[model samples]
Target: MTDDTIKEVLKRIPYGFYAITSRSGDDVNAMVANWVMQTSFSPRQVALGLEKVSYTYGLIEKGGVFAINIFLKDGADALKPFMKGRSKNPDKMKDIQYSEGPETGSPILESAAAYLECRVVRIVDTGGDHDTVIGGVVAAGVSSPGEVGDTLSLPDLGWSYAG
Candidate 1:
């Protein structure tokens, strides 16, 4: 297949957008992430693909915890500030309203449709642009009180993050 065809095919795969938060000491950061998946049903584990250079990755490595904030389909605009890499913008989480997850101490987005706090089980070198970090869910909850629409997805936002 042509390169463009491969990209289009990859884009066709359904993927949800999330605000992944990690903390180290007093530092906390959030980033727009699209490569996360539930890996195990028994233990309720999740695997997140994070670039090696990501500031949040560094925090997750050190803190051994993170939180996945599932955004609402109609709240994509609220997540725009976190779409930038924290390496370029150190204060990415500044002025954003969030609360510390009781289980992992990771920042949970106040406006997310749902939130999952996880404790890192391990990280594997993917030999790609991103490393695979596996985590076990410790706590989870729904942020919104009323009925919520579908979680935000790449196609819903007309965005592309993977090849």
Candidate 2:
């Protein structure tokens, strides 16, 4: 298989869109991420493919906590503020409205339909540009009830992150 073929196949894999928030002391950041999913049932763990150099990655490493803010399809606008990387938009979290999660102290966006607060269980080197962050869900909440179909996804925004 060729590189193009591999990218095409990987892009076809469906992904949910989410705002991943992290904090360390006074440093807080949020970024738009799609490479997140549940990894275990017994321990209620979730894996997030986080870029090694991302601001949130550093925060998570120091704070040992993070939050996945799940939005509805109509809440795409709320994620726009976090689309740009911290290097480009240093004050991205300034205008956003959120409250600290109970267990992790991670920011839970008000726009999120639901959220999962997680404590870092491990960070595994994937031998790629991104590292796999396994977090155990320590707390969760739903502000707006909805089905899976109502959740926001990459396709909903005509975007692709996998290759």
Candidate 3:
């Protein structure tokens, strides 16, 4: 299949959207990402894909930990600033309102439906523009309990990776 066709096919695969947060001392960042997944269950593990150029990548590298916040459908609007790279401003997260998770200093949005705190176990070079950040799940919680009405994931909203 052609690369474009392959991308289109990949686009059809449903995935959830998450705000991956991390901090390195004073350097903190979050990215609106859809390419994350739970890869193992024995000890529990989740992986996130971060672009080499993203601010969140540096924070994850230095902090060695990260948090993933599963935003509610209405909460997705909060991601607009970060998606535009305006998260560089220290006060960017102020509007989101969050509480620190027990496992890390990374902010977990108070509005998120659930959260996962992870410690980096390994990072594999995806050999192109992004790095696959594999982290061991150290902590997790669901603030809003439900089998329905969480939020629409990337594919559910027909999102594509343009950045």
Candidate 4:
């Protein structure tokens, strides 16, 4: 298949947009991420495809924990500040309102409808630009009740991260 064809197919896969937060001691960060999904049910695990060189990746690596902040469709605007990488928006988390997750101590965005705290179980080198971080869910909370259909997604913001 051609590159354009591959891009088209990759972009066709649905993805949800989220603010992924990480912390290592005094350092903290939040970034926009779409490559997140649950990988297991028994132990409750989730995987995140994180750029190997990203600032958040370093924090997650050093701290061994992270949090996934899930927003509602109406909360799409809340994630805009994190759309930029740390190099372009170094202070993105400076003024953001958030609370520390009880288990991981990662930031949980105040505007999030729900949040999941996870502890790093493994970081796999996939021979790609991104590494797959497998985390076991340690804690979770729902500040605002909602169904899966009420969550915000990449398409809802007219953005694409695949292909």
Candidate 5:
């Protein structure tokens, strides 16, 4: 599918919004993605499909771990700025405001509804601009109430994906 069509299809797939994060040395990166999902329950695996060019992807490849913070609708306004921008900026995490993950160096946004710390178990090239990263969850917990702000969805917001 073309990038537009692929994004359109993906939009139909309901997803919990998340800011997946990773780091390499002082280079910390975080990207907002809606394509992440849990792939397994027995071993507690989660799959995150991120573009090959993402800074977070490089960090996961080099550092071997990643963290995910499922965002809440209440904070959607807080996350809109970082949704579509080059991640080379060292201060990309500035607006994000977070603490380091306990197990991984990944940044954990305190505003998230829930968070998960994971180690890469496999990385597969999904033949598009994105790679399918399957990881095993080491730790996970809900920071706020066991519920998200508003369960934001694409249809609910009427946004067209271009990034």
Candidate 6:
């Protein structure tokens, strides 16, 4: 297969935008991610792919937990700040209203349409730019009723994280 074919094939896979949040000591951080999927059903596991070098990855490793916040399509603009590789501001959570999740103590954004608190089960080195972190869902909640199917997807933001 050619390079174009590879890119096109990867791009064809559907993805939903999510905010992956982690905390270390008193510090917390959130990053925009699309490579998140449910890997198991019986134990309720989730796999999140994050760049190995990202600050959020370090936090997850150190904290042993994380929270995934799903946003609505209408709130796509609110997630732009998280897309940045690094923030000049010391407190990235300052601009947003969020509360610590009871399960993992990770910041759960109030703006999220739904949220899931997870405990890190294991980390798999993908031997690439990213690593797969498996998490066990401990807690989850939806902000409002009837918000299902209104989540922000990659196409909704005109963004592509695939090759």
TM-score of each: 0.93, 0.98, 0.88, 0.97, 0.83, 0.94
Q: Find the number of clashing residue pairs for candidate 2.
A: 0
lDDT of model number 5: 0.76
Kindly list the per-residue Cα lDDT of model 6 for residues 117-163, writing each as its tens digit.
99999999979899999999999988855444788899877889998
| Highest-TM-score candidate | 2
Name the weakest run of 10 consecutive residues (lDDT summed) in model 5: 146-155
RMSD of 1: 1.6
Listed per model in order, the count of residue pairs whose N, CA or C atoms clash below 3 Å is 0, 0, 0, 0, 0, 0
| True-vs-predicted CA distance for residue 163, candidate 1, Å | 1.0
For residues 1-163, what per-residue lDDT tens digits would candidate 4 score against the true structure?
A: 9999999999999999999999999889999999999999999999999999899999999999999999999998898899898998988988899999999899999999999999999999999999999999999999999999999999987889999
Query: Which of the predicted structures, 2 or 3, would earn the higher lDDT when compared with the native?
Result: 2
Cα lDDT, all candidates = 0.88, 0.96, 0.79, 0.95, 0.76, 0.89
* lDDT: worst 10-residue window of model 1: 143-152
lDDT of 2 at 96: 86
Off by over 4 Å in 5: 1-10, 87-90, 148-150, 160-163
- What is candidate 1's lDDT per residue for 11-76, written digit by digit as tens? 788788999999888889899899999999998999999999988889999999999999878889
Give me the overall lDDT of model 2: 0.96
Top lDDT: which candidate number?
Answer: 2
What is the C-alpha local distance difference test score of candidate 6? 0.89
Model 6: residue 1 alpha-carbon error in angstroms: 1.0
| Candidate order (lDDT) | 2, 4, 6, 1, 3, 5
* lDDT string, candidate 2, 1-163, tens digits: 9999999999999999999999999889999999999999989999999999898999999999999999999999999999999999999998889999998889999999999999999999989999999999999999999999999999998999999
Candidate 1 displacement at residue 108 in angstroms: 0.7
- Clashing residue pairs for model 3: none
